[model samples]
Target chain A: MEKTLTLPSHITTEKLKDLYKQMWLIRYFDEKVDQFFAKGMIHGTTHLCVGQEASAAGAIAALQDKDKITSTHRGHGHCIAKGAETDRMMAELFGRETGYCKGKGGSMHIADLEKGNLGANGIVGGGIPLAVGAALTSKMKKEGYVVLCFFGDGASNEGSFHESLNLASVWDLPVVFVCENNQYGMSGPVKEMVNIENIAERAGSYGIPGKAVDGNDMVEIINTVYDAVENARSGNGPSLIEMKTYRWKGHSKSDAKKYRTREEEKEWREKDPIQRFKEVLIEEDILTEEQAKNLQEEAKQEIDDAVKFAENSPEPSTDTLLEDVYA
Target chain B: MREITYLEAVREAMSQEMRKNDDVFILGEDIGVYGGAFGVTRGMIEEFGPERIRNTPISEAAIAGGAVGAALTGMRPILELQFSDFITIAMDQIVNQAAKLRYMYGGKGSVPMVLRTPAGSGTGAAAQHSQSLEAWVAHIPGLKVVQPSTAYDAKGLLKAAIDDENPVIFYEHKLLYKTKGDVPEEQYSIPIGKADIKREGKDVTVVATSIMVHKALEAAEELEKEGIDVEVIDPRTLVPLDEETIVNSVKKTGRLIVVHEAVKRGGFGGEIASVIAESEAFDYLDSPIKRLGGLPIPIPYNPNLEKAAVPQVPDIIDAVKETVRFK
Candidate 1:
C-alpha cells in the first residue's frame, strides 16, 4: 500500500470507501459462485477475476454514471463495480427469471445499461469496437459522456482491438481503451501470446497515447484511467491504458491451469488487491481495522443474501423463452 | 412518385432519417468526402457534415461493433460495410454483440442499428468481395435480415430498418444499385417480416429475395406468354419471415419455387422451403418444391464466371417453367 498516495480531486473519501466495498462485493460474489459451481448448483462455465478486482473497481470508479463500458467474459467485477445488484447477477448465474437477462444470459453476459454497462461479451476482444461506437455517439450527439472499453492481454492480438483503436483514433472518438493485461489469456502467457514487452506499446501503431500501470495498486489504476477518460471527454481522442494484473483462478471452471506453477499463484496472492486497498484505507485513517473487518463481513452478507434470493427465484418459463428475441 | 436508382433510394432514406432525427447518423469507410465505394452515401456528408457522416478506417469489425455500441447508448447508427462480403471480417461483432445485446440484456437496452452492405456476385470482386451472405445473418435469431430488390422497397425498407429496435442486416445487391424504379418522395416505411407480392397469378408461386425478385418477375412475364401464369413473391425480410403470405400464395398456385443469390446449400431458401413444407400449403402442393440459388463454389472474378455463379433472369425463367410444368 502506498501511504503517501494523493486521491484525485473529484474522488472523495466516501467514494474510495464505496470502491473498496465494491471490490469486496466482487470478490465475495465470485467466490460464492465458485462454491455453487463446485456444488453443482450452477451450470455452464464462468471465468472469475478474483485477483484482478482492482483493475475493474479502480477504472470504473474513475468513470461517471453516464460513462459507458464494454466488458469481457470474466466480467463479474466490472458488473459489480458499475453498480449492478448482486442479487440480480446471482439469479442470472443461477438461471432464474429475476436475473439481469432473465436467465437468458449466464455469467458471461451480465449487463446493466441504466448504469452504462454495455454487457459482458462471450467472445474474446468482442467489446473493443463497441466502445468506439459508443464514443462516436457521444461525439456525434454531443452527449458529453465517454466510454471505457475493457479487454484482456489476449484481446490485444485480436484484429478487433487493432481496428477499434485505429477507428477511435482516426475519428477522435471519446473512448478510453483499458486493457486488463491479466498475465495470461486462457493457459497462454502474455509473453508467448504476443511479441511485445507491454501491450500498451501497440497503441503507438494507432497514433494514440498509451500507458502501463501497476494494476494491483488501486490508486494508480484510478489515476491512470481518470486521465484517459478526461482526455477523451475533452475531445482529445482515445487512449490505451494497460493494467498489469493476474487472475487468481483458472480460465474457466474446467481449466486445470497446468500451464502455471503453484509458486506463481502464491506470488500473486501475496499482492492481493483487496487486502492492499484495505490497508491503504486504514493507513489513511479513512476507516479503522474494525470498520474494515465490518466491510468484509457486509460484503459476505450481501453475497449470502444474493445466493438466497437466487435460490428462491423462479425458473424462467418455457413460454417466455421465445420472448425478447426481437425488440 | 419519382423514379430513382436503387443506390440513390438508399441514400435518400438515410438522408431523410438523419434530417428528421438528431440521433440518426452514418459511419463507414470512404463515406464522408469519398462518398462510399459505391457512392451510396454521396452528398450525405455535405448535408450532415463530417460529425454526423463519419468516415472510418477500413475496419469492418469496428464499424459494425461501433454501430452496436452507439445504438445501445441511445443513438441510431446506420453502418455501411464497403461490401457485404467484408461482413465476415466483422461477423463476431455483428453476431455476438449487436444481435444478442438486447435479448441478453433482458430487453433493458436495444441496439437500434442498421448494417447496410452491397451484396451479390455480378461485380468482378471475386471470392473475397462478391458474396450474398444474407443467409449467414438470417440464421441468427436476434437479428432482422432484409434484402430489397426495387427502389421502392429499398427506400421504404431501409427507413424501417433504421427505425428498428434490434440490429437489422440490410443487404443491398451490387447489381441492383443502378437499376431504376418508382419511389415516393415522401417518407415511408415498409414493415419488416412482410412479403411483397410483386406479381400475382394462379399457376405457381415464385418466392425470391433481393435481385432474384426482379428475375422472378421477368420469368413470370415470359411464362405468361406460354399460358403458365406465375406468382412472384419477394420476401424483402427473412428472419421474421411472412409465412402466411407465402403459404397462402402456395396454396393458391399449388406449386412453389424458392430463389436467392446465396448458395443453394444451407441458404435462406432452405428456411423458406421448410416454412412452406411445414405449413398447410404442403398438402395443397401439386408438385415437389423447387429451389434455385448460387453455385456451391466461390464467385470468380471473371465477368462470365460471376454471371454464371448466381441465378440470373434466364435461370429463374427455367426454374419457373420446370416448376409450373411439374405434375
Candidate 2:
C-alpha cells in the first residue's frame, strides 16, 4: 500500500472536504442508476463512470466559473462536478418533461449552459472539436476562460482527437485535452487497440506538452490540471493530460464482463479513487470516522430525493416534441 | 449599389460582421495568409490580425466542431471548409454535434455559427473536391441550409446566417465566385426562409439553387425568344424551405421544374417536389412536376464529363419545355 500523502499548500481542508462530497455524490448517483436499470425504470441505456470520480472532481476544481467543458457519454460525474442539479439530471435520465433536454436526450446528451458545460456527446471523440471551438471563442473574444475537454482512452484513437489537438496547438487555443484512460473502450482493451503504451505520447505529433497522471490521486490531478488551465488562460497553448483511471461497472446495461478476469477487477477495485482519498483524509486527521460517515449519508439522501423528484415528474407532451428542433 | 464578385460579397459579409462585433471570427485552413483555397479571405488577415482571421491546420472535423464549441461559448465563429466534398470527413461533428446540440440541450442554448463551403463542380477538382453536399446537411432537422446564387444574396444571406441562433450551412458556388452582381455597401440581411423570384413569367416556374439558378435564368432568356414564358424562383435556404412562395408560384404557373447541381437520388429537389405533392399546390398543377439534377455519380476529373454529369443551361431549357409540354 502507498504511504499517506500530505495535501498541497494551496489546497485547503474545506476544498478537499467539498471534493470528497462531490465524489460521494457521483458514486451514489451511479449506484442509483444501476438500481434503476435493474428495475427497468430508466428507458434507454447509460454509461456509468463509477470508479472515475477523482478525474472529474479534481480537474473541474482547477477551472474557473466561466471555463467550459465537453463531456463524454459516461458523463454524469463530470456534469455533477461542474455544478448540475442532481434532480434535473435524474429527471433527464428518467425521460421526464422537466429533464435537461425535455426527455429528448437521455444520459448521453445532458447539458448545463449556465455552468459552462457544453454537453456530453454520445459519439466517441465527438466533443473534442467542440472544446477546441470554445477555446477559439475565448481567444478571439479575449474571454480569458480556458476549456477542459474530456474523452476516453479509446477516443484518443479517433481522428477527431488528433485533428482537434493539432488545430489547438497551431492556433495556440486555450484548451486542455483530458483523456480518461480507463483501460478499455466498451469491451476492447487499449493495449490491443493502440500501439503506444501511453496515450499522452501521441501528443508529441502535434507539438504540444503531454503527460500521464494517476487519476486516482486526487491532489495530483488537481495540481496538474490547475497548472495546465493557467497556461491555457495565459495564451501559452493546449496540453494533453492522460489520466489513468478505471470503471468498475460494465460498459453499459448489456455488457456481461466476459473480456477480463475478476483478478484484474479486484486489483483496480482496491484502488477505488473515493476510498483512497477518504483513507488519506482519515490518516491525516482531516476527517474523523463520524464526519466521513455523515458525508456518505448526506450524498445518499440527496440521490434519494432526486430519484423521487424524477418519479413524480410528468412525461413530455407530443405537441412540444418538435418545439426545440429549431431555434 | 456597386457590382462585386460573389467572392468579394462573401468576404465583405464576414469582414463587416467581424468589424461590428468582436465576438465574430473566421477560421479554416489557409484562410489567413493563403487567403483560402479560392482567395475568398484575402487581406482579411491583415485587417483582423491572425487571432480573428485564424488559419487552422488541415483538419475539417476540428474546423466544424471547434466552430460549434465557439458558438456555444458566446462567440460567433464562421468556419470554412475548403471544398464541399471534404465535408464528408467532418460529418460526425457537423451532423451529430453542431446540428443536434441545441435541440438535444432542450433549447437551453443555441449554436450561432456559420459553416461556409464552396460547392458544385466546375473546376474539374474531381470526386474528392467537387461536390454539392448541401442536400445531406439540409436533411438534418436542427440545421439551416443556405445556397446563395448572386452577390447580393451572398452578402445579405450570410449576414442573416451569422445573426441566426441556429447552425447555418452556407454553400457558395465555386463557379459563381467571378460572377458579379450589384451589392449594397451598407449592412443588411435577408430573411432566411424567404424565397426570391428572380424572373417572372406565366407559363412555367423553374425553381433552382446555387449555380443552377443562373442556368435557369439563362434558360428563361433563351425560351423568351421562342415565346415560351418562364418564371425563375430561388428558394435560397433549403432546410426552412419557402414552401409558400414555391407553392404559390406553382399554383399560378401551372407547372414546376426543380433544378440543382446535386445528384438526383434523394437530392433537395426531391424535398421540393414532395413539399408540392403534400400541399394544396398539387391540385393546381396542370402538368407533372419535373426535377433536373446531376446524374447519380461522382463528379469526374475531366472537364467534359463533369459538365455532362450536372445540369447545364441547355438542360434547364429542355426540362422546362418538357414540363410545359406534359399533359
Candidate 3:
C-alpha cells in the first residue's frame, strides 16, 4: 500500500491515530450493517458509507462536542463520526422502540442532538440547507460553533445545494459544505450529471472559495475541512469543499448497479479510504499492524453487540405511528 | 392604527417579529434589497439590513431546509416561500424533517419554525403559482397549518406561529393580500387549531378558511335577506383541527357547509366533514355536511374562469342552501 499523507510533526500523531480508529469503527459498523441486511436481520434499506469514511472523520475531527452536523442518505459514517450510538442506529433500522427515532425513522434518519448529529435524511439534498441554518443559529446565538454538512454528488445537482451555499455566503452563516463526490450518483456518474469538472467549482458562482481534495486521504481531508471550519467559526461565511471519493456498495441493496462496469467498481476499490487510512497509521508508526488488527477486531465486536441489541429490541407498538408523525 | 394592505400587514408582522426577538430572521429569494416579488418585504432590507433580512438563491427546499436547521438550533426562523405551488420542491424538508423532527426525537427538541407562503388563485399567476395546496400540508400530522382571512388574524396568528414550538405552515391567500382589516397596535396572539365565529346564526354553520371565510361572510349577508340565518366559523388552523367548535356549531345549526380555496380532492374541508360525520354531531345533523372549494383542475389564467373555478360568495350561498335543504 502507498504511504498516505500526513501533517507536520507539530500536529499530534495521537489525533491522527484516533481519527484512523474512528474511521475504522465506522467502516466496520457499515460492513456489519450490510451483513445484517443480507441476513434479513435488519429492516428497511442500508446506504453504507464505506469508501467515504475519511471525509466524515476528517470533518468530524474539527468539530467540538457541541458543533452540529447534518447528513444525507449515505450517512452511517457521519452519524458514527458524530458519536451516535451504534446500537440505537441498528435498532432504528429494525423498527424498534429503542431506536434513536423510536422506530419512526429507519436507517436514513438516525440522529443524536446531544452528540451534535442533527440527523440523517432519506431525501437527497435534504440536509444541506438545514446545516446552513444550524450554522446560522450558532452565529446568531453567539455560540462560536460551526456546522458541517455532508452530501453526495447527486445532491450537488439539486437547487437546494446551490441555494444553501449562496445563502450561507450572503449571510455569512457558520457552515461548511462538504460534498462527498463518490464518482457515481446511483449509477449516474458525477462527470455526466454535472458539466463542471469539480463540484467545488460550482461554488464560484456564489462568490465563495471552493476546493477539491483527495477524500481517501484522511490527513488531506482534515486539513482542507479544518480550514473551512475555522473560517466559518470566525464569521467568514461558508465554503464548498468537494471530496473526490467512492462508495464500495450499491446505492441501496435493491440496486444491482447494471449501469456501470465491474471494471469501474474495481478501479474505485483500489482507492478504498478505510484501507488507505490504516496503511497510513502503520507507516507513520502511530499504530503497529498488531494494534490495527486489535482495533479492527474491537470494532467488529462492538458492531456485533449493536446487532444483538437491535435484534433483542422490541418493535414499536402500532400506536407510536400516530404519536411521532407530529410534534 | 396605521393603514396597511394585507401584503403590508404580513411584512409588518415579520419585521416586528424579527425586531422583537433576536432569534427571528427572514430568509427567501430576492427578499433583501429587491423586497419580495409581491412587495411584502419592500423596506425590510433597509431597516434590518441583509444580516437579518437575508436573501437566498432560488431553492425552495433550501429556504425551508435552512429554516429547519436554524429552528433546531434554537433560533426561531421565519421562512418565506415566494409561491405556495413551488412548495413541492421542498416537501420532504417541510413534511419529513421540520414537521416530524420534534416528535421523532421523543420531544427532546422542537422545530419552532414558520413557513409563510402565498396561496390560492385570482392573480394571473397561472397554474404553477396560483394553486391552493394548504390541504396537502394540513394532511400531515406534524404540521400546524394556519390560514387567516383578515389582517388582524394574520398578524395575531403569525405572531403565535413565531412563538409556537412546533412547525407551522402559515398560508396567505394571494387574492387576500389586498384585503385589509382593523388590527390592534398591542402585541397579541391567536391560538392555532381554534375556530373563530365570524358570524352567528341558528339555521346553518359555514365553516371556511382563508379567502373562503370572507366569501362565507358575504354569503351570510345575502342569505339573511332571504330569511335564512347563517353562522360562519373560520378554522384558522387546519391540522390540529378545531373539532369542538365545528361539532358544536353543527349540533346547534343541524346543518354544516365546509368551504376553502383549495381543490376539493383531499382538501382540509373533507377532514372537518369526516370529523362531524364520525362524531355524535352526525345524529344532530338535519342535513349532510356540504363542502365547497376549488375545482379539481389546474387554476386557469383568465380572470373570469379563475374566479369561477374557486369558492366564492355565490358558491358559499349555494352550498349553504343545499345543506339547509338536505333531509
Candidate 4:
C-alpha cells in the first residue's frame, strides 16, 4: 500500500476509518441488491454506483447535519453516506410497508428528509433545481447551512442543470454542485454526448467557480467538496465540482453493456474507489488488515439482516394506496 | 368588500402570505422589477424586497425545481412561470419532481409550493405564449390544480394553495387578469377541492373552468331569455375535484355540459365528464354529456382565429339550449 497520505484538519484517523467503512457499506449494499435483482427478488430496475462510492461518501461526509443533498437515480451510495439505514432501504426495494416510501417509491425515489437527504430523483436532471431551491431557502431565511447537489455526467447536458446553475449563481445561493462523471450515461459515452471535455467547465457560463478532480481519490473529493461547501456557507455563492469517476456496473438491471468494450470495464474495475480507499486506510495505520476484514464481514452481516427484515416486512396494504398523495 | 382585478387578487394573496409568514417567498422570470409578463406581481418587489420577491432568469425548470427544493426545506415558494404554455419546458421538474416527491418519499417530505402561471388565449401571443394546459397537471395524482375564474376565487384559492402542504398549480387566465370582481380586503382562504355554484338553475348544468366560467355565465344569461335555465358550476380545484357538488348538480338538472379553454381532446373536460358518468348522476341523464373546449390545434396569433379556437359565449349558449331542448 502507498504511504503518501495527507489528511485535512477536519478528517481525523477515526473519520478516515468511518469513511472507509461507509464505502464498503455502499459496495456490499449495491452488490447484494444486484444479486437480489437477478433472482427476481427486487422488482423494478436499479442503477448501481458500484465503482463511484468515493464521490458520494467523500462529498457528503464533508457536510454538517443541517446541510442537505439532492441525489440522482443511482443514489444508493448517497443515501448510505447521508445516514440512511440499509434495512429500510431494502424494505422499500422489497415493496414492503416498512419501506422508506411505504412501498410507493421503490428504489428510484428513496428519501430521508430528517437526514438531510432530500431524496433520489428518477429523472436525469431532476434534482438540480431542487438543490438550488433549498439553498435559496437557506439564504432567504438567513440559515447558515449549505446544500450539496449530486447529479451524474449525463444530467449536466440537461436544461435543468444549466437553469439551476444560473439561478443559484445569480441569487448567490449557498449550493455546491457535485457531478459524478461516471464515464457513460445510460450506455452513452460522455465524450460523444457532450462537446466539452469537462462538465465542470460549463459552470463558467453561470459565472461560478468550477473544478474537476479524480473522483476515485477520496481525499481529493473531500478536499475539493469541503472548500466548495465552505465557500457556499460563507455566502460566497455556488460552485460546480465534477468528480471524474466510472461506474463498474451496467447502467441498469437490463443493460447488456454492448455499448462499451470489456477492456474498458476491466480498466475502471482496477481503479475501484472502495479498494483504493481501503488500501489507503491500511497504509495510514487507520485500519489494520484484520480489522478491515472484520469491517467487511460486519457489512455483509448487516446486509443479510436487512434482507431478513425486508422479507419479514408486510406488503403495503391496498387500503393505503391512495394515501400520501397529499399532506 | 372591494372590487379588484384577478391580477391584483393574486398579488394580494402572495403579499399577505409573505407578510404573515417569514418562510414565504416568490421567485420567477421578470417577477421582481418587471412585475411579470401579465403584471400579476406588479408592485410586489417593493413590498417584500428582492430576497422574498426574487427575479430569476428565463429558466422555468429551475424556477419550478428550485421551488420544490425550497418548499422541502420549510419554505413556502410561490413560483410564477410567465405563461402556462411554458410549463412544457419544466414538465419534468413539475410533473416528475414536485408532483411526486411527497408520495415517493412515503409522506416523509412535502413540497409546499404554489406554481402560478397565466393560461388561455385571446392575447394574440401565438402558439408558444397562449395555452390552457391545466389538464396535463391535473392528471398527476400528487399535484393540486386550481383554475380560479374570479378575483374572489383567485385571492382566496391562492392563499389556500400557499398554505396547503402540497404543490399547487394555480392557473390564471390571461384574459381574466384585468377583469374585476368583488374581493374582501381582509385575508381569507377558500378550501381547495370545493366547487362553487356560480349560478343556480334546473334545466341544465354547465361546468366551466377558468375563462370559460365567464363565458358559461354569459351563456346562462342568454339562455335564460330563451326559457333555458342553466346551472353554472366552477370546479375551483381539479385534482380533489368536488365530485359531490358536480354529481348532485348533474343529478338535479339531469343534464350536463363540461367546458374548458384547453383543447377538447384529452382536456380536463373529459375527466369531469367521466366523473359524472361514473357517479349515480349517469342514471339522471336528459341528454348526452356535452363538452365545449378549444380546437385541437395550436392557438393562432390572429385575433379572430384565436377566438375561434376556444369556446366563446355563443358556443356555451348554444350547447345549453340544445341540451335543454333535448327530448
Candidate 5:
C-alpha cells in the first residue's frame, strides 16, 4: 500500500475510518451481487457502482439524516452510504420477501424512506426532477434540508436534466445535482455524447453555480458536497456538481463492455478509491496496517451475514400480487 | 346546489385543498403568475403566494418528477402538464418512477400527488395539443387515471385525487372548461374508482368518459323519444375501474357501448371491453360490447377534420341504437 494523507479540523479520524468502511462495504456488496448473479441466484438485471464508491460515500457523508437523496440504477453505493440496511438490499436483489421492495423491485428500485433515500431509478436521468420536487417540499416547509440527486454523464444529456436544473435554479429550490460522470453511458463514451467538455458547464444556462471535482478523491467529494449542502440549506438555491469518475464494471450485469480498452480499466484500477483511501488511513496513523486489514474483514463478515439473511428469507406470497399497487 | 363552470370548480377544489392542508401546493408552467395556459389558476398566485403556487419552466418531466419527489417527502403536490398530450414528454417519470416507486419500495413511501391536464380535441389545437392519452397512463400497473365530465364531478374528483395515496393522472377536457353544472358549495370528495350513473334506462348501457360522457348523455336524451332507453355511466376513474358497477350495469341492460374521445386502437375502451368479456356479464350480454373511440389518426388543425377524427354525439347516438338493436 502507498502512503498519503490529510483531514479537515472538525472531522474526526473515526469518521474518516467509517467513510472508508462505507466505501469498502459498497465495493464488497457489488462484488457479491456480481457473483450471485453469475450463479443465477439473482433474477433480472442490475447496474452496479463498483469503481464509483468514493463518490457515493463522500457525497452522502456531507448530508444530514434529515436531508434526502435520489439515486440512479447503479444505486447500491448510495443506498449503503445513506444508511440502507445491507440485509434488506441483498434480499431485494435475491427476490426475497424481506427485500426493501418485498421483491417487487430488484436492484434498480431499492429505497429506504426512513433513511431519506427517495428511491433508485432505472431510467437515465429519471431521478433528477424528483430531487427538485423534494427540494421544493423542503423549501416550502422551511425545513433546513438539502436533496442530493445522483445521475450519470449519459443522463446529463437527457432533456430531464436540463428541465430539472432550470426548475431548481428558477425556484431556488434546496438541491444539489450531482453528476457522476463515469466516462460512459452504456457503451457510448461521454466525449461522443456531450458537446461540452464538462457536464457542469451546462448549468450556466440555468444560472446556477456549477463545477467539477475529483470523484475518486473522497475528501474532495465531501468538501464539495458540504459547500453545496450549506448553500442549499441557507436558501442560496441549487447547484450543479459534476464528479468525474470511472466505473470498473460494465453498465449492467449483461454488458459485454466492448467499448473501452483494458489499458483504460487498468489505469482506473490503479486509482481505485478504496485502495487510495486505505493508504491515507495508514499513512496518517488514523489506523494501523493491522486495523485496516481488520476493517476489511469486518466488512466481509457483514456482507456474509447479509447474504445469509437474504438466502434464508421467504419468497413473496403469490396471492399478494394485487396488493400495494394502489396504496 | 349552485351552478359553476368546470374551470371555477377546478380552481375551487385546489384552493380548498390548499387552505385545508399546508402541505398541498401547486407547481407547473405559468401556474404562479400567468395562471396556467387556460387561466385555471389566475387568482391562485395572489392568494397562495409564489412559494406555494410556483411557476416552473416549460418542462413537463420536471413538473411530474418533482411532484413525485415532493409527494414522497410528505407533501401533496398538484402538477399541471399544460396539455395532456405533453404527458408524452414526462412518460418516463409518470410511468416508470412515480408509478413504480411505492410498490417497488415495499410500500414504505406513497406519492400522494395529482397530475392535472386538459385533454381531448374540438378547439382545433391539432395533434400536439389535443390528444387524450389517458389509456397510456391507465395501462401502467401503479397509476390511477381519472376523468370528470361535469363541473360537479370535476371539483369532487379533483379533491379526491389530491387526497389519493397514489399518483393520479386527472384529465380535464378542454371544451368542458366553460360548461356549467350544479355543484355543492360544501367541500366533498368522490370515491376515485366508482362509476356514476348519469341516466338510468334498461335497453342499453353507454359507458363513457370525460367529454364523451356529455355526448353519451345527450345521445341518451335524444334516443329516449325513439323508445331506446339508454343508461349513461361515467367511469370517473379508469384504473381501479368500477368493474362491479360496469358489469352489473351491462347485465341489467343486456347490452353495452363503450365510448371515449381517444383513438380506438389500444384505448381504455379495450380494457373495459376485456373486463366485461372476462366477467359474468359476457354470458348475459344480448349483443357484443361495442367499443367507440376516436379514429386512429393525428387530429388535424381544420375544425371539420378535428371533429371528424373523434366520435361526436351523433356517433354515440348511432352506436347506442345499434347496441340496443343487436338482439
Candidate 6:
C-alpha cells in the first residue's frame, strides 16, 4: 500500500467531510451522465471522470474564492469541485436553454465565470495560456489570487503549455500547472505518449519547481497543492504538479473501450480513490460507516434533483444568437 | 498642435490611453524595445516600461488569448498584431472568445480592449505580411471594427475604443502611417459606430472604409471633374455600422457603391448590400448595389499582385461609374 503524506494544516475533519460529499456527488453525476448519454438524452461526447474523483476534489480543496481554474475535456468533476451548479452543468450537457452557456456551448464548453471556472475547452492546450494570462492579471493588478491550469499528459506536447509556463515564470505570475497523468489520452497511454518519465520533470526547463504526486490520494493532493498555492500567494511564482491518476472508464461516452483489458480495469477499480478515502475516514475514526452511507445517499438525491431541474428548464431563446458577442 | 504622421497618431493614442488608465496596456510581437514593425508603438516601451508595453513572442493566439483573459479580469488590454495578415492565426480567440464573452455572459461582462494592427497593400511587403482584413472582423457581431483614414480620426477613435465596453479592431493602412494630418492637441473622440461623410455629393454614394476612405476621397475628386458628384462615406466603425447614414445617402443619390480592401466573396460589402436591400433604400436605388472589392486571389509575393489583390482608386472609380450610370 502507498502511504501518502499529509500536512498538519491540511485536510481538516470538516474539509474531509466536504470532500467526501463532493467526491460522492461527482461520482453520481458522472454515472448519471453515462446513463443519459446511452439513453440519447445528452448530446455530444463526455469524458466522464468517475473513478478520478479524488484528483478533482483534492486539487481544488484549498482554492480561495478569488482563485481561478482552467479545465480539460474531462472537466465536469473539476467544475463541480470548484462549486459550479450541478443543475446548470447537466443542463449544459443536455444542450438545454437553462445551461450555463444557454446550449450555445455544450458539455466540453460549459463555464461559470462567476464561480472562477474558465470553462472546459475542446482544445487540449487551449485553456493553458488563459490560465497564465489570468495569473498574469492577478499579479499585475495585485489581486492576490492564483490560477490552477489542469491538462492531460497529452497536452504536455502542445507548444502552448511550454510557452505559457515560460511566460508565467518570467513574469513571476501566480499559476499552478497541474498535469493530470490519467495514464491515457484517448487510448494512447501516457507511457506511450510522453517521452519524459514524468510530466512534472518538464517544468525544470522553465526553472520552476516540479513534483509528482499520487493523484488518487486525497492527502497527497491536498498537501502538494497546499504548498504550491501558498508559494504563489506569497509571490513565489508557479509550480508544476504531476498527479499519477488512472481513469476507470473509457475516454468518451462513444468509446468502445475494447483497447484495454477488463482485467486491467478491475485492478485499477480495486484501488478506487473514493473507496480508499472512505476506508481512510473510517480508519481514522473521522467518519463512521453509516455516515459514509448517508453522505452517498445525499449526493445521489442531489443529482436526481439536478436532473429534474435540467429537464424542466427552458431552452435559451434564439435571440441569444446575436448577444454576448462583444461588450 | 503637433505635426504627426498616421504612425505617430497611433502612438499618441496608445500612450495617451495608457497614461489615462492603469488598466490599459499593450502586447504584441516586436512591439516593445524593438518598436512595432511599422513603428506604430514606437517609444511606448520607454514611456510605459516593459510591463505595460509588453513584447510577446511570435504568438498571435497567445496575444489574443492574453487580451481576452486580461479583459475578463477587469484589466483593459490593448493587443497589436504586428501585421493584419497574421490575424488568421488567432481567429479563434478573436471570433470565439473576445467577441462572444460579453454577450455570452449576458452583457454582464465587457471586453473593453483594442486590437490595433497595420493593414492595407502598398509597402510591397507581399502576401504574408500585407493584408487589409478589417472586413473580416466587421462581420463579427460583438466586435467593433474601425479604420481611421487620417491622423485626427486615428487619435480620436483610439481614445473612444479604449473607453468602449467592447473589443475594437482598429486598423491603420500600412501606407497611411507616414501620411500627415493637422489634428488638434486638446482631448477629442470619434464615436466608434458613426460614419463621417468625407465628401458629400448627389450623383452617387461611395461607402469606403480604412485606406479605401482616402482612395474614395481621391476618386471623388476625379469624379467631380467628370460632372459626377460623389458622396464618400467613411464608416469609421463597421460592426455597429452606421446604417442610417448609409441608407440616407443611398436614398439621396439613388445609387450605391460599397468598396473595401478585403476580397469580395462574403466580405463586409455583402453585409452592407444585404442591409440596404432589406431597408427602404432598396426602393430608391437607381442601379444595382455595386461592391468594388479585392480580386478573389491569395495575396501574392509580387508587389503588383499584392496591390491588385485589393481595391484601389481605379477600382472605386469603376464601381462609382457603373453604379451612378451614364445619364
Per-residue alpha-carbon lDDT of model 4 for A97-190, expressed as tens digits?
Answer: 9999999998899999989999999999899999998998888888888999999999999999998898999889999999999989997999
How high a TM-score does candidate 5 get? Answer: 0.96
**Candidate 3 lDDT tens digits, B148-234:** 899888998999999988889899888788887887776678888788999999999889888888888899999999989999999
Candidate 3: chain B TM-score equals 0.97
What are the per-residue Cα lDDT tens digits for candidate 3 across A145-202? 8999999999998877887888788778888899999888898988789998998998
User: For candidate 2, what is the lDDT?
Assistant: 0.91
Per-model CA lDDT versus the true structure: 0.90, 0.91, 0.84, 0.91, 0.90, 0.84
The DockQ figures for the candidates are 0.84, 0.85, 0.61, 0.88, 0.84, 0.46
Per-residue CA lDDT of model 6 for B210-316, tens digit only, reads: 78888899999998899999998988878788999999999999998988888788788888889899999999998888888888876776777777788889888
Looking at model 1 chain B, which ten-residue stretch has the lowest summed lDDT? B318-327
- Runs of candidate 3 with Cα error greater than 4 angstroms are A1-11, B1-12, B33-35, B103-106
Model 6 misplaced regions, further than 4 Å: A1-5, A8-10, A95-98, A317-321, B1-3, B103-108
- Better DockQ candidate (4, 6): 4
For all candidates, what are the clash counts? 0, 2, 1, 0, 0, 8
lDDT of 5 at B301: 97
Residue B205 error for model 6, in Å?
1.2
Candidate 3 vs candidate 5, lDDT winner: 5
TM-score of each: 0.97, 0.97, 0.92, 0.97, 0.96, 0.94
Candidate 4 C-alpha lDDT tens digits along B247-309: 999999999999998999999999999998999999999899999999999999889998999
Instruction: State the lDDT of candidate 5 residue by residue for A48-90, as single tens digits.
Output: 8999999999999988889999999999999999999999899
Q: Give me the candidate number with maximum DockQ.
A: 4
Candidate 4 regions exceeding 4 Å error are A1-4
CAPRI quality band, candidate 1: high
